[model samples]
Target: DAGITQSPRHKVTETGTPVTLRCHQTENHRYMYWYRQDPGHGLRLIHYSYGVKDTDKGEVSDGYSVSRSKTEDFLLTLESATSSQTSVYFCAISLRVFDTEAFFGQGTRLTVV
Candidate 1:
Protein backbone atom coordinates (compact mmCIF):
# COMPACT_ATOMS: atom_id res chain seq x y z
CA ASP A 1 0.00 0.00 0.00
CA ALA A 2 0.99 3.65 -0.34
CA GLY A 3 0.60 4.07 3.38
CA ILE A 4 -1.55 7.19 3.24
CA THR A 5 -4.52 7.77 5.49
CA GLN A 6 -6.81 10.69 6.33
CA SER A 7 -8.69 11.37 9.53
CA PRO A 8 -12.33 12.35 9.96
CA ARG A 9 -13.45 10.89 6.67
CA HIS A 10 -16.63 12.92 6.92
CA LYS A 11 -17.46 16.22 8.53
CA VAL A 12 -20.35 18.62 8.74
CA THR A 13 -19.92 22.01 10.29
CA GLU A 14 -21.68 25.32 10.56
CA THR A 15 -20.29 28.25 8.69
CA GLY A 16 -17.59 30.29 10.42
CA THR A 17 -16.27 27.35 12.39
CA PRO A 18 -12.70 26.16 12.28
CA VAL A 19 -11.90 22.72 10.83
CA THR A 20 -8.75 20.74 10.78
CA LEU A 21 -7.97 17.60 8.77
CA ARG A 22 -5.05 15.30 9.20
CA CYS A 23 -3.00 13.16 6.81
CA HIS A 24 -0.57 10.50 7.81
CA GLN A 25 1.82 8.54 5.61
CA THR A 26 4.32 5.80 6.19
CA GLU A 27 5.89 5.89 2.73
CA ASN A 28 8.11 8.82 3.67
CA HIS A 29 7.81 10.45 0.31
CA ARG A 30 9.57 13.75 -0.17
CA TYR A 31 6.54 15.63 -1.42
CA MET A 32 3.14 15.79 0.22
CA TYR A 33 0.14 17.73 -1.06
CA TRP A 34 -3.36 18.81 -0.05
CA TYR A 35 -6.05 19.02 -2.72
CA ARG A 36 -9.68 20.01 -2.77
CA GLN A 37 -12.19 18.53 -5.21
CA ASP A 38 -15.39 20.28 -6.13
CA PRO A 39 -17.93 20.31 -8.92
CA GLY A 40 -16.26 23.03 -10.98
CA HIS A 41 -12.85 23.40 -9.45
CA GLY A 42 -11.89 19.80 -10.19
CA LEU A 43 -8.88 18.88 -8.11
CA ARG A 44 -7.17 22.02 -6.95
CA LEU A 45 -4.02 22.01 -4.96
CA ILE A 46 -4.37 23.76 -1.63
CA HIS A 47 -0.85 23.39 -0.31
CA TYR A 48 2.23 21.19 -0.43
CA SER A 49 5.28 20.43 1.64
CA TYR A 50 8.69 19.53 0.30
CA GLY A 51 10.31 18.63 3.57
CA VAL A 52 10.00 18.91 7.27
CA LYS A 53 9.22 22.52 8.17
CA ASP A 54 9.31 23.41 4.48
CA THR A 55 6.00 24.24 2.84
CA ASP A 56 4.39 26.50 0.27
CA LYS A 57 0.99 27.89 -0.52
CA GLY A 58 -0.82 26.69 -3.58
CA GLU A 59 -3.21 28.38 -5.98
CA VAL A 60 -6.23 28.05 -3.73
CA SER A 61 -4.66 28.62 -0.34
CA ASP A 62 -6.64 31.73 0.54
CA GLY A 63 -8.69 30.32 3.44
CA TYR A 64 -6.53 27.29 4.14
CA SER A 65 -3.25 26.59 5.84
CA VAL A 66 -0.95 23.55 6.03
CA SER A 67 1.95 22.38 8.10
CA ARG A 68 4.43 19.52 8.09
CA SER A 69 6.64 18.87 11.06
CA LYS A 70 7.82 15.36 10.16
CA THR A 71 8.17 13.23 7.07
CA GLU A 72 5.02 11.27 7.77
CA ASP A 73 2.44 13.86 8.70
CA PHE A 74 0.68 16.78 7.05
CA LEU A 75 -2.06 18.89 8.56
CA LEU A 76 -4.63 21.08 6.81
CA THR A 77 -6.75 23.69 8.51
CA LEU A 78 -9.57 25.87 7.33
CA GLU A 79 -9.39 29.10 9.29
CA SER A 80 -13.11 29.65 9.12
CA ALA A 81 -15.32 27.15 7.43
CA THR A 82 -17.69 28.34 4.75
CA SER A 83 -20.11 26.78 2.31
CA SER A 84 -17.75 27.70 -0.48
CA GLN A 85 -15.07 25.64 1.20
CA THR A 86 -17.09 22.46 1.35
CA SER A 87 -15.49 19.77 -0.77
CA VAL A 88 -13.68 16.48 -0.78
CA TYR A 89 -10.16 16.99 0.45
CA PHE A 90 -7.37 14.62 -0.45
CA CYS A 91 -3.85 14.02 0.70
CA ALA A 92 -1.23 12.80 -1.73
CA ILE A 93 2.37 11.74 -1.53
CA SER A 94 4.89 11.61 -4.32
CA LEU A 95 8.56 11.16 -4.87
CA ARG A 96 8.62 14.23 -7.09
CA VAL A 97 6.43 17.24 -7.56
CA PHE A 98 5.64 16.29 -11.15
CA ASP A 99 5.96 13.51 -13.69
CA THR A 100 5.66 10.76 -11.12
CA GLU A 101 2.96 8.65 -9.60
CA ALA A 102 1.41 9.98 -6.43
CA PHE A 103 -0.43 8.02 -3.77
CA PHE A 104 -3.60 9.56 -2.42
CA GLY A 105 -5.57 9.09 0.74
CA GLN A 106 -9.19 7.93 0.64
CA GLY A 107 -10.33 11.57 1.05
CA THR A 108 -12.27 13.59 3.56
CA ARG A 109 -15.73 14.84 2.66
CA LEU A 110 -16.61 18.09 4.39
CA THR A 111 -19.72 20.16 4.25
CA VAL A 112 -20.29 23.58 5.77
CA VAL A 113 -23.78 24.91 6.15
Candidate 2:
Protein backbone atom coordinates (compact mmCIF):
# COMPACT_ATOMS: atom_id res chain seq x y z
CA ASP A 1 0.00 0.00 0.00
CA ALA A 2 1.06 3.55 -0.57
CA GLY A 3 1.69 4.99 2.85
CA ILE A 4 2.11 8.48 1.46
CA THR A 5 -0.63 11.12 1.48
CA GLN A 6 -0.88 14.37 -0.46
CA SER A 7 -2.97 17.21 0.88
CA PRO A 8 -5.44 19.31 -1.09
CA ARG A 9 -6.35 16.79 -3.74
CA HIS A 10 -7.29 19.64 -6.06
CA LYS A 11 -6.52 23.32 -6.20
CA VAL A 12 -7.10 26.32 -8.45
CA THR A 13 -4.83 29.28 -8.06
CA GLU A 14 -4.10 32.47 -9.90
CA THR A 15 -0.88 33.15 -11.71
CA GLY A 16 1.79 35.02 -9.72
CA THR A 17 0.46 33.61 -6.47
CA PRO A 18 2.53 31.42 -4.24
CA VAL A 19 1.26 27.87 -3.74
CA THR A 20 2.45 25.12 -1.54
CA LEU A 21 1.66 21.41 -1.67
CA ARG A 22 2.22 19.00 1.18
CA CYS A 23 3.23 15.38 1.23
CA HIS A 24 3.01 13.36 4.39
CA GLN A 25 4.39 9.92 4.78
CA THR A 26 3.76 7.20 7.33
CA GLU A 27 6.25 4.72 5.88
CA ASN A 28 9.23 6.31 7.64
CA HIS A 29 11.22 6.08 4.48
CA ARG A 30 14.53 7.86 4.19
CA TYR A 31 13.90 9.31 0.75
CA MET A 32 10.97 11.41 -0.46
CA TYR A 33 10.37 13.15 -3.76
CA TRP A 34 8.05 15.56 -5.52
CA TYR A 35 7.17 14.91 -9.14
CA ARG A 36 4.95 16.67 -11.65
CA GLN A 37 3.10 14.57 -14.19
CA ASP A 38 2.27 16.06 -17.53
CA PRO A 39 0.74 14.46 -20.62
CA GLY A 40 3.97 14.04 -22.52
CA HIS A 41 6.58 14.53 -19.82
CA GLY A 42 5.13 11.77 -17.68
CA LEU A 43 6.67 12.34 -14.25
CA ARG A 44 9.38 14.92 -13.95
CA LEU A 45 11.14 15.41 -10.69
CA ILE A 46 10.86 18.77 -9.03
CA HIS A 47 12.84 18.11 -5.88
CA TYR A 48 13.82 15.47 -3.37
CA SER A 49 14.92 15.25 0.22
CA TYR A 50 17.22 12.63 1.60
CA GLY A 51 16.77 13.79 5.15
CA VAL A 52 15.48 16.62 7.22
CA LYS A 53 16.71 19.93 5.84
CA ASP A 54 18.56 18.10 3.11
CA THR A 55 17.00 18.77 -0.27
CA ASP A 56 18.30 19.02 -3.79
CA LYS A 57 16.80 20.37 -6.97
CA GLY A 58 15.78 18.07 -9.77
CA GLU A 59 15.36 18.35 -13.52
CA VAL A 60 12.63 20.96 -13.38
CA SER A 61 13.48 22.86 -10.25
CA ASP A 62 13.24 26.33 -11.64
CA GLY A 63 10.54 28.49 -10.00
CA TYR A 64 10.10 25.78 -7.39
CA SER A 65 11.40 25.09 -3.93
CA VAL A 66 11.16 22.30 -1.40
CA SER A 67 11.59 21.81 2.31
CA ARG A 68 11.73 18.91 4.68
CA SER A 69 11.56 19.94 8.31
CA LYS A 70 10.70 16.49 9.57
CA THR A 71 11.07 12.98 8.34
CA GLU A 72 7.33 12.57 7.95
CA ASP A 73 6.65 15.69 5.97
CA PHE A 74 7.87 17.19 2.72
CA LEU A 75 6.63 20.37 1.12
CA LEU A 76 6.86 21.73 -2.42
CA THR A 77 6.39 25.40 -3.06
CA LEU A 78 5.85 27.23 -6.29
CA GLU A 79 7.28 30.68 -5.76
CA SER A 80 4.90 32.10 -8.29
CA ALA A 81 2.21 30.03 -9.86
CA THR A 82 2.26 29.95 -13.64
CA SER A 83 0.08 28.45 -16.33
CA SER A 84 2.97 26.20 -17.25
CA GLN A 85 3.04 24.78 -13.72
CA THR A 86 -0.44 23.35 -13.86
CA SER A 87 -0.24 19.59 -13.53
CA VAL A 88 -0.81 16.62 -11.28
CA TYR A 89 1.75 16.49 -8.51
CA PHE A 90 2.72 13.26 -6.87
CA CYS A 91 4.70 12.34 -3.78
CA ALA A 92 6.89 9.31 -3.61
CA ILE A 93 8.61 7.38 -0.85
CA SER A 94 11.45 4.95 -1.28
CA LEU A 95 13.02 2.31 0.85
CA ARG A 96 16.26 2.79 -0.97
CA VAL A 97 17.82 6.06 -2.04
CA PHE A 98 18.77 4.76 -5.50
CA ASP A 99 15.24 3.98 -6.73
CA THR A 100 14.96 0.36 -5.73
CA GLU A 101 11.26 0.69 -4.93
CA ALA A 102 8.87 3.58 -4.59
CA PHE A 103 5.31 4.07 -3.38
CA PHE A 104 3.32 7.00 -4.72
CA GLY A 105 0.50 9.01 -3.29
CA GLN A 106 -2.87 9.62 -4.93
CA GLY A 107 -1.59 12.96 -6.30
CA THR A 108 -2.64 16.60 -6.08
CA ARG A 109 -4.09 18.32 -9.14
CA LEU A 110 -3.31 22.01 -9.41
CA THR A 111 -4.65 24.42 -11.97
CA VAL A 112 -3.35 27.90 -12.58
CA VAL A 113 -5.73 30.30 -14.26
In terms of TM-score, which candidate is strongest?
Answer: 2
Candidate 1, 6-80: lDDT as tens digits: 999999999999999999999989999999998877899999999999999988999999889899999999999
lDDT of each: 0.94, 0.94
TM-score on alpha carbons, each prediction: 0.95, 0.96
Residue 34, model 1, lDDT: 97
lDDT of 2 by residue, 1-113 (tens): 76789998999999999999999999889899999999989899999999899999999999999999999999999999999999999999997877588899999999999
Clashing pairs in 2: none
